[model samples]
Target: MVRAAMESGELAQVAVDVTAEGTDKLFTYLVPRSLAGRLTPGQWVRVPFGGRRLVGLYVGPAERPPEGVALKEIAGLLPDIPPIPAPLVQLARWTADRYLSTFPAALRLLLPTEARRQEVRTLTITNYRLNVDDVEALVSELRRRAPRQAELLAYMARVGGEAERAQVLADLGESIAGPIRVALEKGWLTAGRVARRRDPFADEHVEPAPPPVLTPEQEQALASIRQELIAPPAFRQPVLVHGVTGSGKTELYLRAIALVREMGKNAICLVPEISLTPQMIQRFRARFGGDVAVLHSALSAGERFDEWQRIRRGEVSIVVGARSAVFAPFENVGLIIIDEEHEQSYKQEAPPPAYHAREVAAERARLEGALLVLGSATPALESFHLAQTGVYRLVSLGHRIDNRPLPPVTLVDMREELRAGNRSIFSRALVEALDQTLSAREQAILFLNRRGYNTFIMCRSCGGAIQCVHCAVALTYHLGDDHLACHYCGYTAPVPSVCPSCGSDKIRHLGAGTERVEQELQRLYPHVRVARMDVDTTRRKGAHAAILKRFADHEVDVLVGTQMITKGLDFPGVTLVGVVLADTSLNLPDFRAAERTFQLVTQVAGRAGRGDRPGRVIVQTYQPDHAALQAAAEHDYHRFFAEEIRFRQELDYPPFAHMIHLVISGEDEAAVAATAQNVHRVLAEGGFGGQILGPAPAPLAKLRGKYRYHLVLKGPDVRAMAAEVKACFAAARGKWRASRSVSLSVDVDPVSIL
Candidate 1:
């Protein structure tokens, strides 16, 4: 029998573009009647076009070729690449165009990178239960076999068990697959297939992950989100979670997502997964169970493909993962909760598109009628703007669920501390707070945004600071390694006792960081068990979770950390928070600095007094008059938002208006500069009624060898702005392609164009 049918016909032409532009500039292709078994809709195929063989991603059989075009049958079917469903193809098309990504480009990129090959075994089970009739049939068949084989079957019947393929193979000693196939072919067995995934949560009960009992505040937040998700008629709405630090926003997500699943709809959660440990995944899994699909860059190609398939098939009821998980393939997406929505990690900085996960998820929810709950204690300015305008409903769990009063925040100016001649890492006020909290049997947290041992390696005589050789940045001092390292470029060097240029042994380190603060806290309070969390310490898979768990379990009396301490981690015992450096992010060159500073201080302040012990925060900063510090100390988000929005409106920034940044990058600095200039000129000439600033270098311009130049396109008309930028891109496309290293990115309604 000829199993493969023949759709024999003349070669047809199909245009396929695998680039980001997603152009399906149709090329000619033949339909192989002989390969009818393989020639299916959305099957991947290679083709000969324009003097070269290209991977002509199949879009389906074509009716005819254009005049003067030669056609060829799909050069050959990519047998391993799975067929893409027609509807998904449309969705991909829609996303590509909507996001201003090229259509065919988006489609090709959407396919699993390892789809062509590389399916390997981890481990899985095929469950089966034999009926009485089946057992009887098996016994009869065995009785007809040789005595030993018959005895084996009789033993199986008596045991009333299903044998693993490996066990059967070992028992048979040879050709186990054949016998299993024969038994199935002879209708003597039943089978159910299952696939193994990398679920580390299944193991490791030494530290169990379970949802904590929700406090009243947490319950209120969850109840609000639940109502939004279950609202009748299912109109799309954005719910801003304004819970302060340690307010159990994540716990609310667990409950809301669980409710979403219980309603027979899928829920997708986006976290900075690559930035988290296995223990975090375990927590999500422990609460969500096997129905939760964890997707991130850590998984193998095959694993990602399998997980993506599970999402596409709606086999997984919930997905907990990172930035790109916003694209999880669930048609009936009921809820999307983006935790830590304000963190810059939610933005894909390295990629050309530079998309923020929160924006993407919100946009998707708008399209899918899914309830979008942005769970952030430090809500981004964009979200705050939306909430203020009533575009998004603001729902806050204000007080810590423990019903503890808001932490008392006090700022200690470093200038005063320095003037007082006490150069210790801890300020007098902070030390006093820590002692008081510890005496009360409550935990204290000291936060230093910097992660290194010190601010920099400096020559005392010449006052020269060590800098990264490759980057325009100072090297950070690491006491543990006696090393000077660049945070941006990963450049490292041994600390020099004698300054190389000065030839002096007088080398001094200035400024304190997490490592220094942890050292000082332990030295000053020898009896207290202290744990430090920072980028350096939390690099391990379960480090953050382990530290958080230890702190929650009261294994650690004091937790000294960096900014991670601020992002929602609910603990029942923390009572004191010391901001070792409150002005770190506050002093950035960007206008958003005030907003970031305000969020950071308030967030860390909210972290303390979350337990029943009445948490308090002591902020040490040089600028006591800073508005952000003042507003934060007052726990005044509304005042902060108003002032920040006023600044934004004065500057004609987003929310008040619309802003889009057209970023151009290339190895050729001259070329990028030219492109940026041309784009600026185009926007200026387009008669746009708004700001057209900077055909100039961006913040941290030279990154990873790419000379980046940005053309800031701002206007009141968002649609006009987008169209103008699109025109600018279309004009620059030639220049972009001419340079292999050159790239372009468009960010619409960007939260922080930087």
Candidate 2:
């Protein structure tokens, strides 16, 4: 009976690893008897389908083979690879269904490039010892027909026995891809998996940083987290750590992480951006030493793979990184900490399964029985509301560490500055403060959300603004390059000496940016060294960390940058912070604009007065009396929350209701508009009670040559509304399937409508 069963083959249901929608459904395949018990649910396998081999995740046993067709046998099991944890697989499925994404896309979030592709064969040098005499003959013969292959052999021989095929191809150029293939066919190289060595910090020397003593407020917060940790498994409430900037929230996080680690459990710490990862990793490494593993988008694929391996092998007890780190493969996670939890960077804005790290962290903690801590100076409105509703516990760190006072902020109305005949971008007060700080040799930070030298150029004659030819936005004028570049599309052109419109020579570069601010600093204080940190200066790998490290070492007297500089920085010598334009983000076309503005102001202010010297801030804004700026200046989060929550409730935004932002886009504007109308009509016919607003043009109506139209659905019940929205979309998709010219995305709990 056993032999007959084995010969008949055991059937297994597998989710084929393909990222297309509607292709994520399960298919049954025969698992050879030899690998029957070895293959488990969540294990990766190669299966033959439609006359080709494809990787798939083994879901579970199938009840029976298909009614008509004979089942294809699984080709092979990926060797030495452990099954993905069942909980994560379940989580991925839930994320897919909730986010209107394919299961494979969700799985991609959990498994990065290396882990997913690790099972595939990689080309490596064959077993030819370089010290042997046969190498000369092989090289000579190769040089005759394939010079590139010969050169590759020579390079490899000089380097060592083996190297990654991709690395070699990348180094030599894609022209060598054919040579590599030839080498393998000629038996000069072997195709196999080779261990990749990736060390992102290989060149930099890292020192051990000693943990600071916890302040009383920090200790109190840690105690609350501990109580939750000791509660019944998976039932502990999430804790919202509402601390003021410089209030020792990091210390609380470290102490909590330490406690969890000491109990023989792992922890995951998530920051919001790649820019923050370096500083956060430095602190974590200092406390946890080699036991910490870092993950973020900035790391090379090999580095990320190595980090994942380190985690899987139990070589690290703590993982610190950006949003994706929440998916770290830790079997016994005891704690999860999300720093700067209010950051929009935590939300995945593209490529589906647009899951927020906070949401995932909360769910993961609940599933793993881990204590989840969300630390933020300005908690998200929804999160704070949850705390108020007793769904999450709230803890506060109201004061700065070591009795340091919050920096005093003065709002300088730029309108007032202009009236006083101070036509400079910097207000008189800010200029005076900068001069004083420079003279005293104390550091300062100038923050301007915009990056280039000028926000936009306008003609004095025609009142027309210089704009990107492709995009709807204005072109920013960069100083050094003397070019007008589109911030959205990367389109660049030489700055017109005369206005392109109306042929007027009176072109005015209007708006301040970090580049302009840095240039102005240089003009004002020629003797003081100035460093700029922005997208322009920090595009290269490790540039962010390098610039920050130099600034931390006091290499520059003043640092000018964008929102990247506002958070996760702890430089004591920095006594002054200047907001070049406080109203920059306040005027953005989004509901959370005020919330974002307040958070940026409060966070940047925290950077000041962190050290022994009392700090001061100069906020230059056109709207000084704006509630966001007012609340931030007074450092009154409660007041801001109350005011903002009222607006949110009245406007039917999150915390009071749910929103689904649907964007329809296509190369043809008419087609896009038509599809959007169809979707809207479908939703209305479905009897969805949600308020559906606009088949209107999106803010970026035309981007990358695609015309966009937007529709927003708001209601109290998101789950039911989501189902209705999904069904409506399905009907629209089916109707539009023949041409397939139009496409749409569904963003639930969208951070921005634009």
Candidate 3:
């Protein structure tokens, strides 16, 4: 009866789940030899994944056969093609571990199947070369008699004339095949078959070239980086490049990345957002070859899949993309570069497990023995502290590569501007500066950090105009359209004629936004063209670049924008930078607000006169006395850092101690609050004792229909802190899961309180 369990000599069918848990292993089913020929690795196959019928990537022979359960056989292998290459499997493994995602998920990201697609074909006729002389004669005749046939002949001739047989005929279209058949009958070509290019733009590439030059400081920094790589590899060797704005940090990265590729390895370049990917990728593409893959939200799913596959196949030498690219399936990754690494966009504001890319990149590089370069004009305090304390190597790009001096900053206090009775937010001094700059044929950038202002609508009689129905936040009056909008959840309605609270008429839209600033500037300087750039203008994919190009080309006399104006904005003609609200992000209720305000004020003010023109800056803020505002206005990082670092140490915040943010959110406010309380209790129970700071409602407590609460756990031992967090999640799971309204979100090495 041991009838050999009969499975010994038979083929096996295996299905792998796509979740983070199952991808590393496969479930096997016995298969007779008859269907063995129909199966191949890398092909998509139907299987039960997490209680659902999911298409699992067909990986080679199961390491061990499933013992008792009756395994389902693969319905079919997609493409009925060649086996999947071994190299791609290795790439999948690397990416899966890096992202803490499942191996099957990684594979699915890389491989795309046309299983649910409409069948299509391109038909092309072909002929075997029966005689070389006869083929040449027929080609000559076809080149004149049939121009379409001549096109095909020319292609074959250049690649050593072999005609595509059946598949090519189907792909080239049946109509083209008929004329090709006439040429083939005359012995002009031979037939063969090939996979049609799914994307016409696929494999579009350029040859790699020498990297751009780096300044002396940059060269020295790279020399040290080379020294680090030359030594025995450390699992994680993080390097922070902190330089003034306009420093050659990016070029330094380009050089190091080139060195990596030259050594037969891969690299990943992570930008802050999707908007930056295109520009960053263009640089990589120009320097590297066509194999530079770009991944971002803007890409079509099919295109993203194709690019991911190309990366796994070792066809891509570099991956340039937004936050998600940190998990790219790049094999032998020697380097990871996070440009503008301190930008808040590195932290995901929504979604589960709200991880910060900069912190996660550190973990991934540590795991893979990769060199991590975090470059920022103004490094985050945590990162700067790491560099100062020797946790990371400090590489300074001391001067702008252009060798331009820092812009001269002039502070204009709002109280002083008000004393002049011209409460336009733009001081008379700022106006004179703007007028002079534009008259001299130079561009001006007006910076207003707030989008909708601290602005609000009011009824003179009732003193109350409007408020959101579901939120505790005020409704903003958008004068462009007669609408009242909630910036929190995007609840919008037409502006009411009367105050909802007391039925009072004659509502006044008070305060200023980019729109108001733009309108007033046009009134004062009508001949100067003004373009307002912010969320409202750049919602389109290519809109940001178009506006930036216009500004660079001197198409617009003045540029008015929100904080979006500061990101990678390069223009030598921008001689004056007007900071209409230097204290913008400072008033938020987070401890990091001071640091953020300093970063923005300094970085945005640095925008002026980046060229040889010797730029000037005019900063207007209510709190000119605030240290962040004063220090940024003077471009004195040392003064600001000293004061901020002292505050952090006193409070046992980051640099003094690590902080982990455990955010609890759900549709039910009470449930979310309860979950946070339960988390705090569990932390206390565990006795790991990190300063448990919150059970407070999040600054934006309700977002996108979810009520949020948070706990800022601070401690010196980050490892122990993380472990305690894990225990809390596990301990609270049972109690919370009993109710559908409860969920927990944990963010490690959090960048922002909000």
Candidate 4:
């Protein structure tokens, strides 16, 4: 059968699933005539490769097989599926070329894992809707002969004339299935089936909300964005909406989406974190109702697949989710809004593409001739620089919505607190504010970037701290299980009672995390309800939404969390926000540390005083006088940008010069270090005029059992520098492949150097 199929003249260009460097290209395969029309480009198909059947994307009809090469027949066609939208295919290609990622890796972005296979177990509603006229008579007759049947009929009637069989069983128990069977047999209830989606949020309840009256500032911003939406289908500049925190940026986004929808076009709204998706989606769903579809990492595979299909079918006009939602299948996208655009979370750190969603969204909008709106309390330097250079239009909302005041921030010097004999994690001002907020029946939020119970465990006798064996980082102490775990490598071990290096038992857990702060809050305010929102606490699906919902309903008086709770969350009841440690991220080796610190402080501060009452923030830091903290405390963005941009310019980082970060890693330290130096030499010898730095050990010198080294190239033009770097990498590819242990990865426009 295979020989006969191969002889047939049907051929397809298939993008195999393998993601290795050399194996990223498309291969020609013989397609059976029966599956020719059925299998379209962008549809998943099974193909024989290397003696195994691998799932691959059918990339379109192939021209012809190579001259003397054997063409293997396609193994099978994947189930009922639509071709991935053409725009997405182009975007994926663009992403692959620009980010130095494999085409297959970028293709995987559009195809969810569950969607590779056809058919899913969807729940169908079987059982009748009430025959209203005969219901009373049938019930009257059946009540005498069978009480269970009568009871089933009565229960069905109470549930609004229709119910799924599963719902019926759940409400009445399995024993009631017998009565339901009898009722169906007697024609008392009809049997039917309706396919139901395996929705992850099926258990979650969301109430539709009417759009609010836009503030004057928001109205002006929305009008500008709407104008862009209706503009000519040519290359248009992006619009940067530099709104202050609590300035109704979201309201502007909502109104812009409405305008786009009115034009019969779709929109993609992106938040930076999964924790922010539920609230953002809820808000979008409330305004747009059924027009909203969600995409994020936390969703179950089936839920993601169903949502992707719905989007492709044009069942939804709006997509709201984390970074990946930027690739949503919208045939005619009219608007692309990226909320909290400055966040580093928008950059994919783990994989080859390392693409930034904001960058992708900008290009996508450009290709679709859609209006791109970037909203942020702290915009990235590169984005704001573009606005300043007239490449993007800039709009600003200087005041909070409803004329609410920006929260007054107080920076406490923890050094002073220590000298004054106060050693608690919370400053006196923060404690007092918490007391006042709780007394007023209002809510508060305590933020710490760190998670786990303690930062690290150290023995006072030997001054030795416990660290992860695999990674260069310290092991964090988790509270409940009394174990130490590495955040970078997932390495875990039981906490040592004594220092491993010394024979003394004077070990103590130091530094406060969300867990420690949570424990402290409970101890300090025993009667107040508190909730913790962090990766550990919110690992389960819908946990972010659940925790925020509880806080919104005033079920939680204090919400303690990591950076996840910082952006795009609004709660009028939250009157006070406490920064347990403001200097945690200030001292990282990365140059963007100050920018990140300023953004976090400003963003979390914005979360307060969003309600009717004025809000307050207390920032406790060992270095209260630092420029970033001071600028954040004063709510002075311009000042911070001015100072930070100067330093960035002087240091030749980001806006001043484009950067490409190269990392070489392997189990053998010598091989990895040697490979990194060799690659640097290749670039230098290629006459690339860019400033080359590193071949230095990475901040995380060792991670997940691999020795790591880093190199950076900085140049005035990103495109030119990228081309040169690509050429240099190509020139050295052979040597790298021949080497036994080293591997190289490149990240262009890297978010962080460390």
Rank candidates by TM-score, best first.
4, 2, 3, 1
Give candidate 4 regions above 4 Å deviation.
2-8, 37-39, 117-194, 204-207, 274-277, 686-689, 737-739
Clash count (model 3, backbone only): 22
Q: lDDT tens digits, residues 527-591, model 1?
A: 99999888898776667778888887899998888777776566768778888887888777676
| Best-performing candidate as measured by TM-score | 4
Candidate 1 vs candidate 4: which has greater TM-score? 4
Worst 10 residues of 2 by lDDT: 121-130
Model 2 regions lying over 4 Å from their true place: 1-6, 48-52, 117-197, 203-210, 274-277, 497-504, 731-733, 736-739
Quantify all predictions' global Cα lDDT against the true fold. Answer: 0.71, 0.84, 0.71, 0.84
Between candidates 1 and 2, the one scoring higher on TM-score is: 2
Write one digit per residue (lDDT tens) for candidate 4, span 244-307.
9888888888888888888999989898774365667677767877777888888777688788
Worst 10-residue lDDT window for candidate 4 reads 116-125
Model 3: lDDT equals 0.71
Clashing residue pairs in candidate 2 are none
lDDT (0-100) at residue 725 of candidate 3?
Answer: 62
Q: How accurate is candidate 1 locally (lDDT)?
A: 0.71
Compute the lDDT for candidate 4: 0.84
